[model samples]
Target: MLDRVITISREFGSGGRELGMKLSEKLEIPFYDKELISLTAQETNMSVTEFLNYYESIPVTEQSLEPPLYTSFSPLYEIPISDQVFLAQSRVIKSLAEKGPCIIVGRCADRVLEDSINLFIYAGIEHRIERIISLNKDLDPQLVENKIRETDRKRKDYYQYYTGCEWGKAQNYHLCLDSGLAGVEGCYQAVLSYLGHCI
Candidate 1:
C-alpha cells in the first residue's frame, strides 16, 4: 500500500522544505511546514508568537547542564515549556497523519508518525552557509554561518531531547538525501521514485 504520510527531517538550509513542497505538488497531497505552528497555536489557544517562543526556546537544563532530574513530586505542569510544545505538536502531527497522505516537514514528524516514510535531508556546512547567505543577501557571511550552526544545533538537540535518538542519522530514516549534491528538484524526484518502488 502507498505510504499515506511522508515525514522530512532536514538540516538547516538544506532545502528540505522546498523539496517537500515539490513532492506534495507532484504527489497531489497537502504539505505542512510552518502551517503546523498555526495549527498548534490554535489547538493550544496560544498566539503564534507565544507558541514560537515556547517551541524554539530550549530548556534551561538542556543548555547548561545534563537533563534535569525530575522528582516524583513534580507535576505535569512543571514540565519544560519546550517539552509541552513538542507534545502538543506531536498530537497535531499524529492527527494529520491519520487524515491521509500528506507531507510533513520537521517538528519531529518522523518520530511521531509510526507508519510514515521518514526522510532525512542534509548538506555540508559550506553548502549550508552558502545557501543561507544567498537567501539573505544583506546579512554578513560570518553571521549567516553562525546562524546556520546555531539553528542546526538547536534542531539536533530538540530532536534528540524528544525522541532520544540522534537526529539526521541514516539508520533512523528510510532514505537520506544530500541536498547539496542532488539539489532540491533532484531530491524531490528521488523521493518520489523511492516511494513508487516501495509502494
Candidate 2:
C-alpha cells in the first residue's frame, strides 16, 4: 500500500476525475470526490444543498486580502456561510487524511493535506468540450464549451481565494499531465509510472 495521499486538481471537463478513480481502484485505496460533499454536510450539520451551494466557491466579502484567520476568530462571532462551509470541508479533509491514504479530487484538495501527492490535470479547450459532450449527450456543444470556460474560471478563483496561489501552475504540483494529449488511461499509466519511482 502507498503511504501518501493523492490530491488531484483539474480543469472542468478534464478527465482528472476519472483518472483519480482509476488510481484509487488500482491502488485499492479510498477515493473522495462528491462523497466529500455529503461527509462535509454531516460534519457541519449543513444540508447537502447548502454544501453544494458553497462548495469550492469564494464568498463576496471584501474584508481582507488574506484568508480568514481561524486563529483569532471568536466563538461568539458569526462568519459567512461560505466561510463556514469551507472550514467544515477543510476539517473533513484533514480528518480523512489522518485516517489513511486516499485520493482527493477538487475542492482545493491539493492545498488541504500536509503530506500528499499533488497532481494537476488540464486539457485544450476543444478537448475539454469534446469530453464533456461525450459524457453528456443531451447538452449542447456550444453550451458545453461555455460552461467549461466559466467553470474553470470559478475553480481558479476559488483556489486563489483560499490558498493565495495561482491555480494550475506547473510549479505547484508534483506532476502535471495533459489529458487531452494522452487520454485518460494513458494519463493513468503515466501516474502509475511516476508513483513507482516515489512510492
What pairs collide in candidate 2?
none
Model 1 lDDT on a 0 to 1 scale: 0.81
The Cα RMSD of model 1 versus the native structure comes to 3.4
lDDT of candidate 2 at residue 192, scale 0 to 100 = 95
Residue 12 error, candidate 1, Å: 0.5
Instruction: Tell me the TM-score of model 1.
Output: 0.88
For model 2, how many clashes? 0
Best by TM-score: 2
Cα deviation at 89, candidate 2, in Å, is 0.5
Residue 120 in candidate 1 has what lDDT?
93
